[model samples]
Target: MQATQPLVGKETAFITGGASGIGRATVLRLAEDGFRVVVIDRNALQVEALVAELVQAGYDAVGHAVDVCDRSKISALIDAEARVDVMVCAAGIGPSCAFDAISDEDFRAVLEVNVLGVFIASQEAVRRMKPGGRVVTVSSRAALGGGGFAHYVASKAAVVGLTRAMAMDLRQRRIAVNSIAPGFTDTGMTRAMTPAQHAAASALEPAGRPAEPHEIANAIAFLASPRTSFITGQTIFVDGGKSLGGLGL
Candidate 1:
């Protein structure tokens, strides 16, 4: 990881699903970069534990057990903050199911967390953000195209569209918006896959391995930084060439 210059002042970062996986990694990276990180997640115990750890490490941090889809609660938290310099919509769910096996409820659940959650958080955060603010949404390489988890793919694709529209809308405000489309990453979510499924994913990766959460965080941190002022409305693929095509399945 490249060293980041400590941000001066009390610049605050709000990250949803920040208790684990990519979200957790981003929280640590942002905090290390000198942002006062505010972690929001549904896992109360994990939220408290992570915040405690950051505090013990001498980093400015706090946490709340809040679902990203809860607009009122998310808005209230953001409203309470003095200022929100960065917002990372890392909260998402991707349950793999065959298209034929996907029930309406299953599909809705994925959209609720993966799409609506990001929309709600980004909306509230953008309202509170000022010029030069940053919003980074987590999309996925699957958003490009995939077989299993149709709902997950659709939700992520929506995120990409939403990100582009946000960047255009916020250009006048000078707030940059971007999305990172990570490939197969080693996280609790990926670990949930059956061993065979996991092995297949890893084999498909051009790097011959799954990405570490911190690797995805690295791209996110770059987009979240004020230095990326001119870059917006883009989907960066940190997929280790998996998205380059011709994997020969």
Candidate 2:
């Protein structure tokens, strides 16, 4: 954990998994929106690349290579920050496996990354935050109920529940907590799917295509903005109507 550039008058946003996928998109979007962004990711090279890109683009940004599940390290990182105006929990893992065949180790791994990771990061960031701070979590539409990834679905469902509880607890402090549930999005995670699986997912989308990472980032940016002070404890679905569930007429 290297020392970040000084945070001037600008608000600071600390984001986990900000090296790629929706997390990377959010980092870019928030930086463009004028926040001094702090990116945390497990990949040191990716973190360096992103931070360099941001600095070259004239954005105040820094990157840290740390796993979100490392609670003590995450807490220390957040503690070192002058102020964390926003925290986005976007680190998660979703491996497809049949429920009957899912190993205990596999299921626990998903929960640790998806559920425990969010809890640790959010708790740490909020401790250093002021009133009106924001926390945006990334969940998935699979939480609504899906097949082949029981572990993922369960973890995301827990995130939604945690968001609601956090909102209630933090309401008096004027901090807003919300979540975004993205459908099949064009991310590295989704790109790892088999070709047939990818095609089937796209075909099932009512929008006839997977969401772009920026699309989900756009929604997250909105939730993290000052304008969303009134919106909390809600799950905004950026799933292109996949959650609507009625097949194409």
Best by TM-score: 2
How far off is residue 246 in model 2, in Å? Answer: 2.8
Q: Mark the regions of model 2 whose C-alpha exceeds 4 Å error after superposition.
A: 1-4
Query: lDDT values of the candidates?
Result: 0.91, 0.92
Q: What TM-score number comes out for model 2?
A: 0.97
Off by over 4 Å in 1: 1-8, 246-249
